[model samples]
Target: MTGGVPEGPGDDRWGSDGGWDDGSLDATARVVDADSSEEERRIEAALRPRRLTDFPGQQRVRDQLGLVLEAARRRQAPPDHVLLSGPPGLGKTTLAMIIAAELEQPIRITSGPAIQHAGDLAAVLSSMSEGEVLFLDEIHRMSRPAEEMLYLAMEDFRVDVIVGKGPGATAIPLELPPFTVVGATTRSGLLPAPLRDRFGFTGHLDFYSTEDLVKILTRNATLLEIEADPAGVEQIASRSRGTPRIANRLLRRVRDWAQVHGRHVVDLPAAEAALDLFDVDARGLDRLDRAVLEALCQRFGGGPVGLSTLAVAVGEEPDTVETVAEPFLVREGFMVRTPRGRAASPLAWQHLGLTPPQGSPGAGAGSQDTLPLSGDVGRFSG
Candidate 1:
């Protein structure tokens, strides 16, 4: 699959009208710095798979989505509204763009936060042309009223436009053009039942495998004109937390390091040196991740600690710590979330090169001598 659109090297042209410059595409594409250069954004846009065949991983979703788009094309009708739910950076937005491209329809991108009121959503819905793709990202965050409006729009293709004050309000039924709504959310369970039911198709994206990520990274390296070895690509893929965005980001960082060190290619040593310079370990844990583990173990004695307290210990936001850090830590068995609070696991202690204290929940020791809270620190060699 050609990553949805066809473009060659130095082809920085980003679709008709430069879709990214309008500020709609940046919300999902900018994974690194908020102040990312325009060139960086262009490179990311160029990397996107324009068609379904080109998308990597998610075989089930790819096949199902292809069938949906193909059937819709055969009928000459708009495809059903698609709901894509998963953790961030797993290619929900990319799939949305591919849906539009496959249907040869234009896409209007926006987020739930952008639509504060029912009227806000109504305006966007009213303006869309027939068969357009309306991509509403973070749909769970939308206001209830707007969500209710969306329900009516999705089911009946009509919205009751209120024109005046409460008692004197005039209700006008407005007919909308046939359009496909592709909604993406990290927290699918948070969506109201009626809203969730409106979607005809739902796809849940999972983490990419190392082989899949290697394919993605290799494609990206070629697109970026970076000379990267297979080993270097594998090393980055293994440490990418199964995320394509992170793999691409690591590749860029490795490229930058190699350029700075007068190296012409991204070899194993270049990749390792660059990753070490950036503070990412072999197991893909970054500085913040290590800090959270360290705090939960040493500072809290491996006891159940509150998420907010842990975030405070690291001087980060509770949401950031929970959403960005806790998921992977919990998934990798480094931490556990109980009804009481968050707690470090035995693996966390082992990874940090420290022995778990006796009688602690994660220590797995029964009536043994208490180990020192400060054990010998060792460099992570994952």
Candidate 2:
């Protein structure tokens, strides 16, 4: 027996830390990286509509983008560098890919975080061929150095490479190949003003309408070969938070339910059952969402609660609760943002199975007490 833990005869040549013993560490690293890359590729590919025609929703954006791309192609020039801003899962990435496809150009994808230094961006830009689309996702997060380099690259098609250190350094103006840059960001507000002004075109993506989401769900269901009732599709669409990604995900879950329950097609019942299992309520509020409403109703008496206070009550980041959960609630008339803070609408109280408190200050007055707050209602009444 060996003095230390025996490594077995064949394992003696390798180090004790499992380095090279079986190449496990290397294999593990490669596997993890490969899996991550594969996932990214899958997302990029799945959400990428093969052509503008396959893209189901955002009709206005589609029409406007079609014109821009066509004009660029007719003129035989690279399309204008575009900026897309929107909430996540609203098809910003898809539109970027569509722009490249429509322009018949190769798109080199990178993110703000990937360009750690000016040199990093210079390397990527310098390597590009003519007419390439450089997609910088989350461009707002890019380092200051990289962003400064981008200003010159976007405006002049050139970069000044500084060589050597300190006193010995000299900037060599290097001409770059002409390319279009498409930047996508969830927070366009965070992008520096100078950088913001550099893009030739900016597209603001908004949440899809229930009708658009219905169309998206039906199209995806047809493609996936799942038989879904129109009513089922509509139900799923209404609950999807006006996002195609969420709509598609809901459709798939309902399809799974149909399959497991031996139903030949997904009907309204199946859709309801699936959504119930997923904890998406009739108004599409999930558990976390319900918790927020419940807190506002029961704890704060339907609340003029601040966002930070609400987030603390729900145990979530204020931003996440605001951006992700609150939008749907607001859209559905379950909540309203007040000058004071956030307050639950009458519908919100109803949804939470709670009676609207008597004489709640923000509750619209003179309407039948039973009536939920309507868009036309005044902010306050005597």
Highest-scoring model, lDDT: 1
lDDT of each: 0.83, 0.77
Ten contiguous residues minimizing lDDT sum, candidate 1:
373-382
lDDT of 1 by residue, 225-247 (tens): 99999999999999999999899
The C-alpha TM-scores of every prediction are 0.88, 0.82
Alpha-carbon RMSD to native, per candidate: 7.3, 9.9
For this target, which candidate reaches the highest TM-score against the unseen true structure?
1
Tens digits of per-residue lDDT for model 2 on 1-382?
A: 2211123445553335432232221111111123446654453355447688888777777888888889999999887889999888898877877787788766666678767888878767766678877778889999999899999999999999999999999999999878899999999999999999998888888888899888777777776788989999999998888878778778878988999999968889999999999999777789888989988888888877788999999999998888888877887777777656777877777676677668663355424353434564435221
Model 1 regions more than 4 Å off? 1-33, 365-382
Clashes of each: 8, 0
